[model samples]
Each structure stands twice: as C-alpha cells, then as structure tokens.
Target: MQKNYEYDAVVVGSGPNGLACAIQLQRSGLSVLLIEGSEQIGGGMRSKEFFPGYLSDVCSAIHPMAAGSPFFSQLPLTDYGLEYINPPVLAAHPFDNGTSASLKSSLYETANGLGIDKGDYLDLMQPIVENWPKLAEDILGPFKIPKELIASLQFGLSAMKSAKWLSNRFKTEEAKALFAGMAAHSFLPLDQLSTAAVGLVLMANGHLKGWPLPKGGSQAIANALLSYFESLGGKVQMGWMVRSYGEIPPAKAVIFDTGPKQLIEIAGDHLPSIYKKKASEVSLRPRRI
Candidate 1:
C-alpha cells in the first residue's frame, strides 16, 4: 500500500506532554508534525472567559508543581512573553468554624498557624523540605526507581496513615480539621491510604513553593510552547484525527497524546496481543481526567 503523507515523526494531540515531546524532537533536527483532534490546541491547559472579560482556568486552576516540575520549569516560557504569578498564600482551607489554615510557603509560618502541633509538623516536613530538590527530580522524572526519592518514598509510606494517625499526633480539633481539609483534595475517601500521601505532599509544597498560575491564562503557556516548537521548524495541524495506521504519515515513530484505548484501536493489529491486553489495564497518564 502507498503511504499518503510523510514526516520523521507525527505526534497526535497537542497537550503539554505531546507539545514538549514534539518541541524536543524538532529541536534535535527531526521533521515533526503535531496533529490535534480538537479545533483548538492546548488540550487540558486550555482557558476560557466565563464572565465577560474575566478569564477563568477551565481546569487545573492552581499549578503547584510547575516550578518544581522538571519538564515545564525548563521551558523558557518567559522569554516568549509567558509569566506566572504566585499568590502570597499557596492555598487556604476554610473550616466550618470560621477558621482557615493556609499554606504560607514558609515552614515557621505554617507551623505557627497549626499552633499545638507546630513542633510535630515541622519535624515531619523539615527533612522533606531540605531534600526538596531531590524530591522534585525523582517525583517528576521518568524514573520507576530513582535513587534520590528512596527516602522520601519510605517517608511517604509511613505518612499514608490517614487523619486518624494525625488525630493521635495532635490534641487539637483545629489542627485535625486543617489536615482533614487538605487531605480531601485527593478525591479518595479521607480515610483511604492515598489521601494521607497526597495531603502531606501538598502541604509540604505549600511550605516550599506556593501555588502559582500563569499570568494571562493557561493558554499563554501553551502559546509560548507552540511558538518555540514552530521556531524549531515543527509543523502543527489542527482538526486532524488519526483513525488508523492508514491515517498516520509515513514516519519512523508515531506517538499519541490521545487515550491508550484509541492507540490500541488504531494500531492493535501492529502491536502484540499481550501488549494490548496490558495497555488495556493501563490508563493514559497524560490525560487530566
């Protein structure tokens, strides 16, 4: 069969990870084609005006890991007219009793807000904060077992003991409520083991790097990246969907930013049966939902 299109690489979907991959491939002197099924680009990092001129982030309002995020932080977005702003307090959890506990990006300030459990909170977080660089690298990197994150992972295992463990650690209701509110961000049940790890990590980030949002909107970040990709000679095509291998251009590599199921549906015959079985169990990590 004769192929219809040609490129060194074709990246399906224009999400951050896809864009990043396309940008890097183009930078390395490869001809790259970025295809987006949606009419507009910036998949999940998209923004819209909810009220008149007031723009609201459609999804992922606060970017806690952007600065510590190895992939995003390395992109010189600012040079392309993209900027980020950090609110003084990272995030605040308001309790029913009219009291709120906020993350200040400062250990002492956060501990002071915790009052009675101040000392214990500091003791638990200091080591993590001290090793945040290593923590950031290991957690964000494409490493299954990065050496720097071993201690943090072990610490995380112990921290996974829920609000019940926290109640035993602190004698104050205020402290417990504060931690509880933070843990609820996990979407998992509060008592679930996953809640403990998520809440603790988020709180630690608050005391280390305050939650920041890109100024102008999330699209600005995407535009910056898109500009860079174009600068490196990458071509992006909007409103294009790869339905099968026939739809893909002749290329050495084809990467999909779409769902893994879509990948299987599009290329199942080319892939090993066992590979498709395993991929069926594995969710696409790049997707936000």
Candidate 2:
C-alpha cells in the first residue's frame, strides 16, 4: 500500500541553516515543511528586549561571514525586508594603554592602523585576503584539495598552526591582541590548532566585507529567509516538537538542523549504531561556530 505523505521534505529546525535548507529545497520545486521547536520562527536569530527599552544580540551581532557568504549573496533578502547596517569599522580592539587598533574593509587602512606591526599585519593577512575568492568554495563547504593550489599554501599554514604560534609573528600588542580576540571566537584556547584559521578567515572577511548588523535585529535575517521560503509555497509549523520518528510527517527526506542529541532522541533506534556512537561524542552549543 502506498503511504500517505505530508510533503517532499521536512526541515526539523527553524534556525538559519534550517531555513536556508527549506528554501533551497522549495526552490528546487519540492514541497517542504519547516518545523520549529520554539514558538518563534528564528532560532538563534532571535532578539528581544531583555532589558527595558534596550535590545542586545544574545548570539550573533557582528556578521562579516554572513555579509560575505556566497550563498546569501545570491538571495534577494532585501525584497523580504531584510536590511543591513554597515558600521564604519569592522571591529576595534582596545588595549589597557588607552589605545586601540581598528579593522576596516580596506587592506591598507586596517594594516596601517597596526602602527609598528603594520608591515607584519599586511604580510600575514595579505595572502589570505588575496586568496579568499579561490578558497571560499572549499573553505565554506566540505574539505577537499583546493581547486586553486599554488596560492593556498598560506591558507594551509594558518589551518595547521595555532593562533598563539601565529601571534609570535607580530611584535606589537595591538596586532597580537586583535588576532587573539578574533581567534577567541572559536571558543577554543589560542594555543590550539584550527584557532588560527578561524581568526585568519574572520580577519580576511573583515577586509573583504565589513561586518554588518541587521537593521532591526538578527531576527530580521530569519524572518527574511522564512518569508522568501513561504513565497515559494513552503509550509511552516511553530512550537512543534517531534518526539520520535513516528511523530514526523511522512516525507521523502528529512533534514535535521538540530544537534546530535536531538537527532538521537527523535530518531531513536532507527539510526545505525555507528552513527549513534559518533554522534554521542559530539557537544551542543547555542550558536554556530
């Protein structure tokens, strides 16, 4: 007997990734059902007045990555009422000496602000900024040998070294502290590997595209994405929690925008032991890394 199905696909979360996934599926001429655990549409993209008359971003505030994202750059989010406010400076790092270093979209401007480390900053960051267009595809997607190899050595070097090791290249406190602050966003100690890549990529994005803020709140981003998806005939359900595989409406495919725990909890024994074993070792955090 043919099973009664709900949609072509069911997206398990309403976060940025989930919304993007649904939108992509819908764009491909598939009927999609977007389910959100919370009553709110956006997940971490949510913003509220935590304090009276004052609104602050709980997770993502600065968005160099989103502004420069190849995927998002293709979307007509502005038509959905999403607006970005670009600040004059991408980021500013202040020191105890009553001085600060500013990062701007222009390579010369940012490098020039580093004072004694001016040359060093340019030397270290120039390769990254120059090679970004070639590396963006591999860096942002699955790991693979870069399609452009000759210019990727600098990128590989940063990926393998620790931010602390890279900091040794700079003599000035401003340069060291600035890189370290950006590296700290990785939620890893600066002495570890992979952290330098985070800082390097972030710095490169700042030079390529200034980190901009959403006009109203981060929620505007989610709203815009969702609105676009809805226009494509996608269906959404808020405050819906699927406790088990049976709870999920029949769909040809299911895309989980949730954590491993949520996957394990909802799918239960349906998943292979190996997958469950690997997923059990992972951890969950509120924001994307």
Candidate 3:
C-alpha cells in the first residue's frame, strides 16, 4: 500500500528560491513545508554582526537581480517590511588615473561618465534596456521560444561575443574596465564566449531598476518573504538537514535549492542514471582556474 504524504510539497533549503517556491505552492492551495538545514531560516540572505555594531550580509551584498526580477516585482514584500535603498551610483570602477566610471541609475548619466565612448555605450545599452522585461524573462530560464523574438535575437547575437570583444567597442579605459568588471562576475575569463551576456544583463538591470539594498540588510528581504509565507499558512522547519531521500517525509513533490553536486549526492540513486551522470558532469566552480 502507498503511504500517505504529510505535505503536497516539501522545499529543501530556506533560501530565497525555496521560500518563494513554498509561498507559491501554498498560494496555489497546496500544503507546503519549507525546511532549512541551518538554524537560520535564510540561507545566503542571512545577516549577522561581523564587527562590533556593524551588520554584514553573509553572501549577497547587492540586489540588482531582486530589483529587476519579474516575480519579485509582483510580490507585496514592501507591505511586509521590505524596504529597498537605492544608492546614488549603482557601481563604480576606478582607474589608475584617479578617475572613476560609475553606473548611475539614469542611462544618460552613466554614459556621460564614459567620455568619448558615451555614444557607443548608449547605442549598445539603449535597446537592451528598453526591452529588459522580455529579455530578462527569456534569458533567466531554460531554452524556449521567446516572446520577443527580435529583441531576444539581438541580445543573443551580442551576448555570444566575448567580454574583450564587447569592451573593444568603447574608446576609454574606464568604459572598458566597467564592462570588464561586470562581465568578470560570471566567473569566466573575459575572453571566453558569452561572457558579455552576464555584463549586458547586469547593465540592463542597473538601468531598468536601480540596484538597491534591502534596508537593515539582506536579512530584511528574507524576513519579509518568510512573513509573507507564514501569512499564507505555509509551514517551515529549521535545523533539519536532509542528507538523503530516505530522510525526507513522503511528499507529492520536492524542490531542492542546492548545488548539483549535493543534489546528486542526496538523490543519485533515486534519479535516472543518465540524469545522475549529467549532474555529476556539471561544475559550478570556475573552469579557467
């Protein structure tokens, strides 16, 4: 006889993704349980006092992606005490010449800092920024037919190029360095293929929605999300580490907010052999190292 399940869904890990998943599941009238391995509910979103009287975020510092996310925008997080603080400058890249190129919320202001390369910067970013809503939806997910085909094609063509190639379009060292810094976040070599893609998306995010930090710390975002989740009657269990599939309670579905290696380790025997092989091949660490 099949055993009865306790929850419709069980989300492992209480990170932003896990919390969001649990909230969505509960909103859809399913009984959801969110579990966290650590004592803290927030995974990377947790904040603590590193220095005396100074709070530091454990993982994520800047929240450009959160500000620009289509799903996050629809959530009533602000009502749950999530306030975002936008800085005057999104980011700054200082050169040896005692000058800095800053990514301002306004595209014109950011381009102005590029000096002679201002026009080129505007030309490269304007169209992408204008269609960021569609581009973000397409690029952030698995391969699919895009809703904005022309915009997606344009972004894909440009993004396929290396960061070095994209930087070459600019005339100033500051502009080049700015692009390089953004692209380097991909953890890939600047000359590697598709490195420009990360830079373009970050740049578009900066222009579309100014990169903002949650007031108090990144924890505020997590707290707000948790508050919202609980309000929807979702349940969370903390300090429960799921080591294997056998440890988890029977559920209709399970969502893991973990790396491929850990996922494979926990569920390898339960998964198809082909999928386990592919998961083992995937690496999150930088390949060039």
| Candidate number of the best TM-score | 3
lDDT of 3 by residue, 156-229 (tens): 88899999999999988899999999999888988988999999999999998888999989999899999998
* Model 1 spans > 4 angstroms off: 1-6, 141-143, 159-168, 282-289
- Per-candidate TM equals 0.85, 0.93, 0.95
Candidate 1 vs candidate 3, lDDT winner: 3
What is each predicted model's overall lDDT from 0 to 1?
Answer: 0.77, 0.86, 0.90
Kindly list the per-residue Cα lDDT of model 1 for residues 1-289, writing each as its tens digit.
7554468899999988889889888888889999988886788878888799989878766766665566667777788877778888877778788988777878888888888889887777777777766677666556477676577676566466765565467666766766777777776666655467666766766666667788888877778889888888899999987788888777988988877799998888899999889989885332331
lDDT of candidate 2 over 176-219, digit per residue (tens):
98999989888887788778988988999888877889998898
* Candidate 2 lDDT for residue 245: 81
Candidates ranked by TM-score: 3, 2, 1
Model 2 residue runs over 4 Å out of place are 1-4, 283-289
In model 2, which range of ten residues has the least summed lDDT? 280-289
